[model samples]
Target: MTTKEQLTVIRRLMGFAGPYKWFFIWSVVLSATISGINVFLPWLLQTYMDRYLRTSNATIQIMWMFAGFYFGGMLVRAIMQFWQNYSSTMGAEYMLENVRRKLFSQLHAKGMRYFDQTPGGSILSRLMNDTMTFANFWALLNTLILALFAVVSSFIAMYLTDVKVALWTLILVPFLVMTIWYYQHYSSKVYRRMRERLSQLNTKLAEAITGITVIQEFRQEDRTSKRFQKTNQSYYDTRKAMIKTNTLLLSPMINLFYALGTALVLGLFGVRGLHEIVAAGVIYAFITYLNNFYSPMSNMMDSLSDFQNGMVAGSRVLRIVDDQTLAPQQHPVAGATITRGKVEFRHVTFAYDQEHPVLKDVSFVVEPGQTVALVGQTGSGKTSTINVLMRFYEFQSGEVLVDDRDIRDYPAAELRSKLGLVLQEPQLFYGDIQTNIRMYNTAISDEEVRQAARFVQADEFIERLPQGYTTPVLERGTEYSAGERQLITFARTVVTDPKILILDEATANVDTETETMIQTGLNKIQENRTTIAIAHRLSTIQNADQILVLHQGQIVERGTNDELMAQAGYYYDMIQLQNAAHKD
Candidate 1:
């Protein structure tokens, strides 16, 4: 990448360092100070050896002074090192937490389109792995800064002691720099590929774990394992390539340069010593400085890979932060509130892909306190209709109005706050039954949660549990029957008391007994509330105020169930098909 682009990435990542900016600055200052001390220590040793120890009149007091100076320098360096490490670690952790918060907030702000297109595993990788890589970025940056100071300060120290030797050592500097540039140029691409492969591996793993039951039931474990192995092997290949690059360009190449520089200096000092032009003490100090030069060079080469990897990870993280596809949850100004819960879709046309419309010029109205049922085959746009009403997907050329105001104008959070959705497969979180009913909304009281469960008759089964309202729900509520989970879902919806209720195939997974219980709960919640339901069971929605039959993204028929049955249209045919299937 160009220098400008790298700087832009660094600047963006640094923006998250707001909470610990001073800490980071102090850490860098301490690192530079430590490097300066290291550079000075060798010179102090040179002074002591040549000026004091070389004298026949050397005294015990002088020896004590030299020891004191050396020990004092070590003490100061130790103190500074502790503070530097503490500051860098604190800053990095704070920045990482802040970054995670931002990323999670962005994910929540995004519309369903983002979730539909992106895999859950890829998002997980970005959240956990990429954020961790970014955390390492601070340490890599610190190392680079310290290495710069060490190299520059060491060069100055060497030049002061003896210019001729320093000039000769400078000859190897360009070659070392070129080696680093070469490693960085190649390693960046390798690390980028490695990170991408890791994300893919994570994606596969998430899918496998989530669908493990399906895999076992279908007897596809061998197939699944093979697929995972392919991803795993690809990731392994990238790691091997990275290791090879490191072996070739980092420590091994650095050691070679160090050896060559050492040999040339020792030969120069041997000749100079014959004429007593350069002192034994000066030669010793120069050797120490040369080692100091190579130490930072080796460190820089090792950290270059981390720097490049961080850059790649940071770029991925920034993409999500800068995503513009999210619906605005908080508007600059509030829109109209839905006091009566009237919903209307006028000339609605939507397409997940523009080439194939999912809802085409559909129009409907659910008057306040009425239940409208939508019936359709798979891909007949039944769920798509509900998705548009919830403002999950952006429609093309349409007005979805609630209370005579465009839905787009309302803040997303405010709009959703008044709407309650119950999915076909009820989802239960890990929490006590009462907390699940409240969904952790602090505004809900324990009494309110209990009353909502009672209203849905879920209190019957809930009270049977060992802890009753306080019973701990397992992951996804797997310990409960499908019916039990659905009943709790009803309680959850009732507790919210949303102005408008949407039931999307909410009865599809329940048995007859459970369906009866759920239907009773549904009836209670639908009282004096606007509701839209999508159901495949023809009998369940017979009492709907209006029924719309959708086919190929268009409403083929619409009316009260009796009105549509009298017309003998698509709705009538669907009922007949269901009845025939039930009889068989």
Candidate 2:
């Protein structure tokens, strides 16, 4: 990123801290207080040496009083340091939490097309690892505040001791400024590359774990391992570059400046001591003030690496929040709802990528309480039609209507609550049977849960388990068979009592017996609801009220089962192929 872009990203990230500005304000106040204390403690010793010790008037009582004042200043400095650290650290933590939540909500608001084009692992990295850097991001501000206060206060004290020495010490300022500029410009590039490498490493690991079953079955473990090692090595190389950049520019350079500045301050004093009397207290106060001037710079320089890392991470996170590939926009009229669930597509055209259409001028209608099955070969647009009708993707140049009104007129909540969807693979979370069936909808009572389970013919097997409806489910319900998992999903949908039921080739993965059981449940549920079914197996949707045969993103024929068979067109050819496969 360029300097302008980096500043823009930093500004956006700081916006999250607006709600906790008081904490930062207080931290700055405390830092200034501590700097004042630092200046006073050094001068107290100078006062005692010059006024009492040099005149040989030092009594035991005076000695105790000086010691007590020095100790009291140290105590107050410690207290100020505590509050400064606490307020600053907590404020940054709050900002990090808010940023993570906003990112998560933004991910949910993205359209299916966004997920289709992005990797799961890249998204995960930005949401989890990148967001965490923000908590440490504010440490840079605290260090900067301390350095600013310390530099000004210590310089004033030094100037009061000897104006000529103080003026000469500033020769190091221009060189220090040049070093800082070089580090920010170069280290930012290194940190950006480092963040990208970390994201790539996360991507490879997520891909490997998700497909581990396929990999082991195909005996591709060696190949996967080698690829992961290569990505890991790239990440390791970036770390080496980052460490080298920090070592070259941060504490080492700042410490070098401190050493040179100190030599200049003392060398001026030594020349004066030869020609005239230079008070011991004056030399002591001048050296102490010089140390104060340089110490905070070393700390600020040490935090520069975190500054760069946080900027890169913050930019990556904000990119998602600013992405335009959002879920389809809806213009709702109040009181509009999907009551009857009559769905229609009026010459709809749709595409995942705007340039190439996957659905072309598709028109179809399914009346309430009727079942319409979509049949076609792979990529023939059967699923695409369902996706458009379901309003999962924005259809280009078309109007999708439900209940004789534009689909967008209905509130999103109404559409989601009334339309039920069952995907090809059944998904279950880490919950018990009853909870999954109701989908954590607390309003769905135990009686309704059992009724829905029985409605889907899933009650028999579920009741046989020791814990029955309360049985604990593990990751994705791995303990359950595919058929069982799917039946539970069926119960999940049934419990919602949807007006329109959607099935995306629900029986393609089950065995013959489970398919038969699923069909029986499906028949009862389709009694008085509008249904849209996509058929992977030709036989599963043979009894649909109307069948639409599609080819190359267009509907070729539409009729009843026997009506389409008599035409001996795409429908008949598909049937013949399936029948032959069954016999083989």
Candidate 3:
């Protein structure tokens, strides 16, 4: 990213701190107060040295009083320091949490095409690692503020003590600025490389884990392991570069200037002493002031690397926040709803990327309480049709109407609540069968859950499992059989009692026995419902009221089952191929 772009990202990240900015403001106040105390302590010691310790009138009582005063100063400084650090840390934490929540919400609001194009690991890395890196940048922010206060206050103190030596110290300011500029220019590129490598490493790791079963089954573990090792090595190389830049450009360089500045202060004072007596307290105060000047600067230098990391991370995270591939929008009118599930697609054309349309001028209508089955080969736009109807993707041109009203005219919730979907692969969360059936909808009582389960015949296998409905599901419910998982999913959908039912090749994965069981449930759920079925098995939808055979991105045949068979077109050929495979 360019320098201007990095600044833009940082500015946007700061916006998330809006609600909790008071904590940071209070911290800034305390930081300034601490800087004041830092100046006061050296002056206090100088006063004691010159006024009491250097004079013959010094007494034990005076020493004790000064010691008590010094101790009190330390105590107050320590307390303010604590609040400064605590408040800044708390503010950073709150900002991190808010940013994470917004990122999660943004991901959910994106269209399916966004997910199709983005890897899960890349998304995970940005959401977790990048946010953490930016949050840690607040430590740099605190250091920067402290440095600002200390540099100014300590310089004024030194200039007040001796104008000539203080003027000489200004000579180093140009060199310091140049060094900082060089370090920032170099380290930003290094951090950007580090961030990219980290994201790639995360992607490799997630892919290996997600497809571990396939890797092991195909005996490709060695290949995956080697690839992962290479990615790890690349990431390690970037870290080594980062460490080299930080070591050379950070604290050591500031300390170098500090050592030079100290030498100059003493040399000037020594020369002055040769001509006339100079108070030891004056020399002591000058050295201490230089220390104060450079110490916070050194810390700020060390945090420069973190600032770069945060800039790069913030840029990546904000990309997701500003993504334009949002879920299809609705133009709903108040009180708009689906009274009857009559679905019609009028010459709809849709594509994921908007360039190569997967659904082209597709038109279909399913009457209320009627079943229409889609039959096609893979990539024949079978799933694409369902995607548009579900409003998961926006069509470029078309009018999809439900109950003769524009699909976009109904509120999104109204559409989702009234349309039921069961996928080929059933998904279950880490919950019991009862909760899964209810889908965490608290309004659904246990009795309703059971009724839905019984309606889908899911209660048979569920009752046999130990603990029945309360049994804990682990790791995506792998403990349950495929048929059992599908049954639970069926119950989940039916419990909502949707007006329209959608089956997306729901029986494609199960065995014949499981298919028989799932078919029984489908039979019960399809009764008196507007149904759109994607038939994976030709025999499954032989009795459909209407059948549509899609080829490429258009419907090649459309008619009742017997009529399509008589035509012996795409539908007839698909059925023949499936029956041939079944006989084998």
Which residue pairs clash within candidate 3? none
Each prediction's TM-score against the native?
A: 0.97, 0.98, 0.98
Model 3: how far residue 466 lies from native, Å:
1.0
lDDT of each: 0.88, 0.89, 0.90
Q: After superposition, how far is residue 384 of candidate 1 from its true place, in Å?
A: 1.1
How much is the lDDT of residue 197 in candidate 3?
Answer: 91
Off by over 4 Å in 2: none
lDDT of 3 by residue, 52-106 (tens): 8888567999888888888999999999989999999999999999989989998
Model 1: per-residue Cα lDDT over 1-584, one tens digit each: 44576789999888899778998999999989998899878888888888877765558998898889999999999999899888988899899999999899889889887887888998999999999998998877888888888888889999988898899998987898788777777888898899999999999999999899999999999999999999999999999999999988988999999999999999988987788766778888999999988898898888887888888899888888877777523342464676889999999999876578989999999999999999988999999988888877778788888888888777666677789999999899998788888988999999999889988889899988898899998899999999889888988988988999999998889899878876777788999899999998989999999999999999989999889999998888888998899899
Clash counts for the predictions, in order: 0, 0, 0
- Point to the candidate with the largest lDDT: 3
Error of 1 at 397 (Å): 1.4
TM-score of 1: 0.97
Cα error, candidate 2, residue 558 (Å)? 0.9
